[model samples]
Target: MASWAEVEADAPEFAAAVRRLLDAHRHKTLATLRRDGSPRISGTEAQFRDGELWFGGMWLSRKALDLRRDPRFALHSASVDPDDDDPAAWPGDAKLSGRVEEITDPARVSEVNKDAPPGPSHLFRADITEVVLTKVGSPADHLLIQWWREGKGLRVFKRT
Candidate 1:
């Protein structure tokens, strides 16, 4: 697993591209495992802060509870339909998969979220296991995928 900073250090261009796609929108989809081993999809917001990827959940919200029980998660950036006339211009979408460690230290939480309300909440930092960015090819005839895995480093491939 690696921190966001570590990924950037290893692959600056790839990390920057992924960050751009992720930051282009506000809302994202998060997938977490339910107690029954089923999957739960929830709306979420995430951030790249202080060399780490961070996210939060409401006080004891289902998503929060799910993470507390099982740290594994997949976060997907919001996407818009590609223009039929110019699919090549699409900015594409990014997906991050990792395990999260709950941050329970009051001081650390305050530092990350200065505007944190006076109530219970959950703050998590990601230990990234994989990062993927998918988009249309320049000519719009194929798909481009750039990915980074914890041990495999970076890989780029195309699908026709």
Candidate 2:
């Protein structure tokens, strides 16, 4: 298999597509692995800033504890209307493969929250590993999405 950089280089547009989707969508359904090896999914809003994806939750939430033990997570987002026929085609929707890190520093967490308050907000910083954009082909393959990811940031990928 090729390296992460190699994969990202081969599909530059995919990365752009993911960024666009993120900008349009405000909510995401995060799927995490439980200690028992099962999967748990929950809906939450997200904010992307400073090259990281930030998510807030209650400290006692199951998703919070799940990420504490296992940071890996998958996110799914969908357009507000599946039948809409406007530009930005499917509106905002995507699947993201990433890992989460608990934001414990009061200042940093506060920064992540910004207008939103800290405490009761369990923040996680998602380092996007891979991103998939679905729905593009024919009706049979109406969900032909593209995926891309780099080991580092966009600047590094541009150099490589």
Candidate 3:
């Protein structure tokens, strides 16, 4: 796993594209493993701060509990419909998968929550295992998919 900063250092172009998609919206869909091993999807907000991707939720929330038990998670960026008449206008979509370390330090948590509503919360930092972006191709009949994983750098695949 690698920090977002590490990813940027390793693959600047890929990292920049992913960051663009992530910054295009404020909320994302997060998937976590439930106690029974089923998948749970929830709305979440993430921040890129201090060279890492961070997220938090209300204390003891189901999503928070899930992360505490099993840190594995996948976050999908907000999506936008493509302009069928102009595929190039599509901004694209991105997904990130990683493991999280719960933040227990009061000082760090306080800093993370400075802009948030006052209340107890759970916070975590992610170590990314994979990142992906998908966008409509100019030809309109194809899709361009790009992904990066630890050790593998970046790879692209197209679907027609």
Candidate 4:
């Protein structure tokens, strides 16, 4: 697994595109594994701070519990509908998969919650395994799919 900083260092351009997609929206869809191994999708907010991607949930929330039991997770950037006739206008979408490292330090948690509502929370830092971005290519039917995995750098695969 790699930190967001590692991706940026290894592939600046790809990382920049990913940052754009992720920063374009405030909320993302996070998929976690349930006890039976089924996928559970939950709405989540992510923040890039101190050179890391951080996220959290209200204390004891189902999603938080799921992460505690199974740290692996996939986070999808919020997407917007594109202009069908002009694929180039599409804002594109991104996905990040990794294991989460729960933050339990009181000082760290307090720092993270400084602007949050008054309530207990569960905070975590992401250790990314893969990052992917899919965008409409020149042809309306084609997609420019780019992905980066630890030690693999950036790769592209197009499909119609």
Local distance difference test scores for all models: 0.93, 0.67, 0.92, 0.92
The residue pairs found clashing in candidate 2 are: none
Query: Which candidate achieves the best lDDT against the true structure?
Result: 1
**Prediction 4 global C-alpha lDDT:** 0.92
Question: Candidate 2, after superposition: displacement of residue 19 in Å?
Answer: 2.9
TM-score of each: 0.97, 0.73, 0.96, 0.96
Please give me the total number of clashing residue pairs in predicted model 4: 0
Can you list the residue pairs that collide in candidate 3?
A: none
Model 1, span 1-160: residue lDDT tens: 8999999998899999999988988899999999998999999989999899999998899999999999999999999999999999999999999999999998999899776678878999999999999999978999999999997899999999
What lDDT does candidate 2 reach at residue 49?
69
| Candidate 2 local lDDT, 37-95, one digit each (tens) | 89999987877666556787787799988999999888887456655454235543677
Q: Can you rank all candidates by lDDT, best first?
A: 1, 4, 3, 2
- Candidate 4: 10-residue stretch with minimal lDDT: 111-120
lDDT by residue for model 4 (1-160), tens: 8989999999999999999999888899999999999999999999888778999998999899999999999999999999867878897999999999999998998887577777688999999999999999876678999999998899999998
For residue 54, give model 3's deviation from the true position in Å.
0.4
Among the numbered candidates, top TM-score falls to: 1
User: Distance (Å) between predicted and true CA of 35, model 1?
Assistant: 0.2
